[model samples]
Target: MEKMTLPDWMKEAPTAVCPASSGKERKGFLDRSLRNFASVLKRAFASGKTKDGPMQNLEPRAKLAGFFLLILAAALFESWIFILALLVMTVCLSAMTKAGAAPLLVRALPAIVFTAVMAAPAVFSFVTPGAPLAGVGGLTITAEGVSTALFFVLRVSAIAALAALLVLTTAEADFFRGLGRLLPGFFSAALFFTFKYCLILVKTAEGAALARKSRTIDSRGVKEAQRWFASRAAFILKKSLNTAEEVSMAMVSRGFEGRVATAPAGPLGFAEYLWLGASSFFFFLSFGF
Candidate 1:
C-alpha cells in the first residue's frame, strides 16, 4: 500500500476555537406548547387508522348516537359511582378498539387536568358549605365539596374519554359525513368548516412557533416575547381571514349555495344495534343512581 500525505489543515491545530454552546438551545414555552398541541391534534385526527376493531366496524351514525347517549348519561347522573362505572366502560371500549392506554392518556390528560383544576374550587368550604373533610393550610375542604369535586372530575373524565375513543376508532371522513347526514345541511356545513378551520389554525400556529424559534438565537425579555406573540397572533388572525376568503371563493366556484351535500350514512347492523343497546342500558342504569 502507498503512504498518503495528510492535508496541512488536517495535521495542524486550529488558530481559533469554536465557542461551546451556552447550554442547549431550549424551545420557548410557547414553542413547546404549540408543538405539543399540534402533535396531539394530529394524533387525535390520525388515530382512526387502527386496522380492525368492534368500534371501527360499527356505522358512524350508531357510534355517534351511542357515544352521545353515554355522554348524556355522564352529565345527567349525579352519583360518583355511576360516573366511575361509565369511565370503566369507556376504558373497556377503548381497549377493544385497540386504542392503547398511553395514547388515551395523552389525548385525555389536558381535559382531565383542566377539569380537575376547575373543580378544585368546588372542594373548598367557601364554595360548598358542609362538614369539613380535611384542613389544608387553614382551608377547610368540606365533605360535600369533596364529593362534588370528585363527581365533577369523574363525569368530565368519562365524557372526555368516551369522546376520545369515538374519534380514535372512527375515520374522520366517515364520521363527518355521517354527522352531515344526521344534521341539517346548513348546520352540518358550518360544523364541517369550523372543524377544518380549527385544524388549519393549529397547524398554522405550530409552523409559526417553530419558525420563530428557529430564528431566535438568544433569549429575549418578557416584553420582546409579548410583542413577538402579539405579532404572531395578528399574523394568524390575518392568515385565517385569508383562508376563510379563499375557502368561500372555492365553495362558490364549486356551486355551493349554502348547503353541503353528503352521502347517506350506512344503515345500522347487528353491531350497531348491540352498541345502542349497551348505551341504552347504561343510560337507564345511570337513572337508578
Candidate 2:
C-alpha cells in the first residue's frame, strides 16, 4: 500500500482545542425528575402483578365492593377521627400486602400534597370566618377554618389512600374486569383503555426526555428551555391524537363496537361475604361515631 501525505492546509490548520471535560457530571434537574417519574410509574405498574399477598387471592369484585363502600363512608362521615382511623387501617392493610406501603404512599403522596396545598387557603379567616385561633402577618387564622381545613385534608387523604390501596393490590386486567361488572361495560372499558394509554404516554415522554438529555451538551438559556419544552409538549399532543386515532381504527377492525362485553360475574364466596360484612360494619359504625 502506498502512503499518502496530508495537504498543506491540513498541516497549517490550528490544532483543535480539546473540549473541556465536565468531570463527574451531575444529572440535570429535568433528567432527575424524569427518572423519578419513571420509577413511580414502574412501581404503580408492578403493584398488582404479584402472585402472593394478603389480598391477592381475594376476588377483585369483592375488593372493589368493599373499597367502594369504605370510600363512600370516608367521604360521608363527619368525624375526622373516623376518617383517620380508616386511613390507619388502609396503611396497615398495605403493609400486609406484597406491594408494601412505601410504593403506595409514594403514589398517593402527590395527591395528598396537592390537596393540602389547595385546602391551605381555607384556614384563613377570609375563607372561613369565625373566632380567631391565631394571627399571622396581620391575617386572622380562625378556629372554624382550622377545623374545616383539617376535615377536608383528612377526608381527601383517607379516600386517596383507599383508592391507592385498591390499585396496589389488584391486577390491571382483574381490576378492570371487576369494574366492568360493577359499572357499565362501556364506561369500564373507557377507563381501562384510558389508563393504559396514559401509561404508554408517560413511557413515551420519558424516552423522549432521555433522548433529548443525551443529545444536549451545553446548558440552554431559560427562554430556550421554555421553547424546547413547549415544542415537546406540542409533539406529545400530536402524537397522542395520532395514537388515539390508530387505536380506535384498530379496535374497529378487531370488531370492537361502542359496547364492551364483560364476562359474567360468579357467585360471591365466604371471603366475599366477609369483606362485604366488614365494609358494612364500618360504614354503619360511623353513624354511632
Candidate 3:
C-alpha cells in the first residue's frame, strides 16, 4: 500500500495531545448518560411487543391477576426449591410468550446480583445464628445463615424474573388499563402520566445532549462537565414541569376529567379461566411446601 501523507497542519500538531483536548472529540458525561438512558428506555418500551404468543391471547385482567397470585406465592415461600420452581415457571412463560430469553436475563441479572450483595452479610454468624461452617478473622460463616441468604437471593431473583416477564408480554396501554381497573382512578392516571412524561424527559435529554455535542469543539474538565450535567438536569426538570402543564391543558381540551376511563374489556375466555385455575392451584400448593 502506498503511504498516506499528512497535511502541514496535522504534521505540526503535537503528537501527545489528548484526544478530548485535540480536534478529535469524546463523549462527555451528559452524552454518555443520555445515550445509556435512551438505550435502556428503548429496550424497556420495545419489549412490549404483543405478537401471536400465548400471553397475547389472554385477557389483560386475567394475566394481571394470575401474575400477582404467582408473585404472592413466590414471596410467601421459604424453600429454595419452591423459589427455583417459580423462576423456572417465569422462564417457561416468557418462552411461551415469545419474549426473548436474553433480554429477560439481562434485565434480571442486575437485581439478582444486587440482592445477593445485600444478603451477603446474612451469611455471617454474627448476623444470623447457626452452626459454624467456615470462619474468617472475628467472623464465622454458618450453615443456617448461608441457607437463609441463599433463600433470600433466590426469592428475589424469582420475583424479579416474574415481573420482567409480565412487562415483556403486556402492551403499555393494556397494562395501564388493567391497572386503572384495579386501582383508584387518580392513582392510575398519575401512573400513566408519570410513565408518559418519563419517556418524554428521556427524549428531551437525548436531544439536548446531541445539541451540546454538535456545538462543542474541545472537551472540558470533569468539574465543568459535572456543572453542565447538573444544569442540564435542572433544565430537564423545568421542561418536564412545563410539559406536564401543557399535557394537562391538552387533556382538559379533550374533555378528560381527573380520572382515567378505560373501555370495558371483553369477558375472559375458557382458556383464560383454565389458566387462572391452574395458577390458583399452584399458588395454593406453594403454601403446603
Candidate 4:
C-alpha cells in the first residue's frame, strides 16, 4: 500500500484555525456565535430558563414517573381527543408551575416541525381501504391517511411536551439523583457522567467554532458548506475528546470514580405514592380508558 499525503488538517479540525478576526464585527459575531452555542447547550441540558416553575418543586422521582406515563399514553393514543387532552394537561401543569406558555412552545416547536417533516408523508403508508377525502396536486388524500397523520402529530407533540415538562420541572442534578435511587449503581453512575460530560463537550465545540469562523467565510454554496461542516465536525470531535481526557484526569486526581457523591434520597413518603397514583390515573384516562 502506498502512503498518501493530504492537507495537514485532514487530521486536525475545529480549533486549528484560530486566526485573528478581520474587524470588530467579525469579533463580535464570533463572541455571539460562541455564546449562542453555549446557550443552546445550556437548554439541551437543564437550564434556569426552563427550571423556574412549580413543576420544578415536584419530587424528581414523581416527575420521572409522570414523564414515563405521559410517553406511554401518547404512544398508545389513536384519537385526536386523547392528544388534545394530553396537550391540555401539559398546559395546565406548565401553568401551575409558572412555566410560561411561550417558553413551552419554544421548547416543543422543534419537535413539532421535525414530526411534520417526517410523518406527513408516512401517514399514507398504511393501505387501509378507505374513501378519498380529497385530491389536490395529483395526489389523492384518503380519510385514513389524514386521520393517521393527525394521530402521529398529536402523539409526537404530546411526547415532546412531556419531555419538556420533565426538563422544566427537574434540575439536572436532581434528575440524576432520582435516577440513581431506582437504577443499579453502575447505571446511575453512567447517567451522571453522561449529564456531566455533555456540557463539557458543548463548550469544547464552542471554542472550536470560534476558531473555525475566524478562519473561513460562511459561504452558502454546497461545496463550501460541506467543507465547512466536515472540517468543523472533525475539529469539534478532537477538542471534545481532549476535554474528556482532561476531565477524567481531574476527576481521578480528586478521587472521583464515576459514581456520584450524592446524599441518598432516603425513603419515599406517602405523598410520593399518592403522586404516583395520580400519574397512573391521568395516563389511563389519556389513553382512552
Q: Output the number of the TM-score-best candidate.
A: 3
Q: Cα-based RMSD of the predictions, in order?
A: 4.4, 5.5, 4.2, 11.1
**For candidate 4, which ten residues in a row score worst on lDDT?**
16-25
lDDT tens readout by residue for model 1, 243-278:
889988998998988766777566778888998999
Q: Which pairs clash in the backbone of model 4?
A: 13-235, 14-235, 54-97
Clashes of each: 0, 0, 0, 3
What local distance difference test score does each model get? Answer: 0.80, 0.82, 0.82, 0.71
Question: Of 3 and 4, which scores higher on lDDT?
Answer: 3
Instruction: Report the Cα lDDT for residue 234, model 1.
Output: 98
Off by over 4 Å in 3: 1-7, 10-28
Q: Please give the TM-score that candidate 1 achieves against the real structure.
A: 0.79
lDDT of 4 by residue, 170-284 (tens): 7767777777766776787877777787787777667666665666654346676567668877877787788779978998999987765546675666666776787687678
Q: After superposition, how far is residue 153 of candidate 3 from its true place, in Å?
A: 0.8
Per-residue lDDT of 1-289 in model 2, one digit per residue for the tens? 8899998988884542321233433456666777787787777676557647867667888889899999988987888888999999999988887667886787688889998999999999999999999999999999999999888988998999999888878887889878898899889988988878878888888877767656666667678777877888898899999998999999999998777898888888898898889998888877767
